[model samples]
Target: MSRDRTRTRERSGDAGEEFDAEFELDSELDPDADEDRTRADPDDASGGFRSRAAERAGALFAPRIFIAALLVTVGALFATSTFIPLPGAGLAGVFAAAFLFGAVLKDRRYAETVLSGALAAGGSAVLDFAVVALFGGVGLPLVAVAGGLGAVVAAVGTYFGRDLRKGLTQDL
Candidate 1:
């Protein structure tokens, strides 16, 4: 009304009930600008690397991180041992730690970090088994029994320590 410097009025049977229902535009706002800003999927987040990567990121990280940590711990302990001059023992321990960690942490991507390590450890343990067999020190059956015992220990640790068994049934 101030811009126009004029006004109009209407009366509804002298009750002053007439209301102005029309809206006048200021001419500065664009009418069709908003349509361009929206998209069907906006950045198309559901397709390509973003989608799979987002899904796998969490799955891959869990087992690998735990395995790495376990390897570090087992490796440190093996290195600090005074008697065994075999660096291969430390390497084998790292691998066994990886396998134990993988099996315990998550079912997904379990063997990638630990498989090679396990092979090396298996060879070393076999050699140890032969020596123990000849000398009646650490024989094959004894080592096998020890291995079974170690598995039980690891299973219990995974169960009570981090609840890794729960990860197996997690919705992928």
Candidate 2:
């Protein structure tokens, strides 16, 4: 079977005049058509590699997820420092924030979730370093260690959160 689709395009210029352009597209409805193609082959030369790379990058470090994780981690750390005032309060806050974020995350991909947690931890570590630097001189090594530890802690927390989410959603 064949179908005709009509599309209208409206154009306006600086002269304030408007015109409408109409076009008809003829398409054939074929049962054998490849309609289920989801991803482009990476080896293809016609921009497929770029698109595939972009898709992988987007999946790994989505901007929205990264920003949300960073904000949540920072907020939790600030709240913990202000209210708890414990020795390891920042780490505890990061873990809790990451756990809650992971549990609420809609994406079920493991790599993305873990990477988001790590990035968030690293960002919070930098922020903490900046704040501490204002008080007195601090060593870069300390920041590095804090970032590494935060990454590990956040990763563990996110893992447990994901497990909790899976357990809750699964059918008995």
For each candidate in the order shown, give its overall lDDT on alpha carbons. Answer: 0.47, 0.67
Model 2: clashing residue pairs? Answer: none
What TM-score does each of the candidates earn?
A: 0.31, 0.65
Candidate 1 deviant stretches above 4 angstroms: 1-43, 46-49, 61-67, 70-77, 80-83, 115-172
lDDT of 2: 0.67
lDDT of 2 by residue, 1-172 (tens): 4445576766676767777776434324554332222233334445656766898898777877766777877777768867986655777887887788778886754454455445555655566567675466664665667767777877887888888988999999
- For residue 96, what is the lDDT in candidate 1? 43
Candidate 1 on 1-172: residue-level lDDT in tens?
Answer: 1121234466778787875554434222544333332233466544544756877876665555645654553454355333456643444344345545545654544333433344333444555557666687656665455444433433443334334445655687
Model 1, position 18, has a per-residue lDDT of 73
Candidate 2, superposed: residue stretches over 4 Å from native: 1-44, 108-138
Best by TM-score: 2
User: Which residue pairs overlap in candidate 1's backbone?
Assistant: none
In Å, residue 148's CA in model 2 sits off its true spot by 0.7
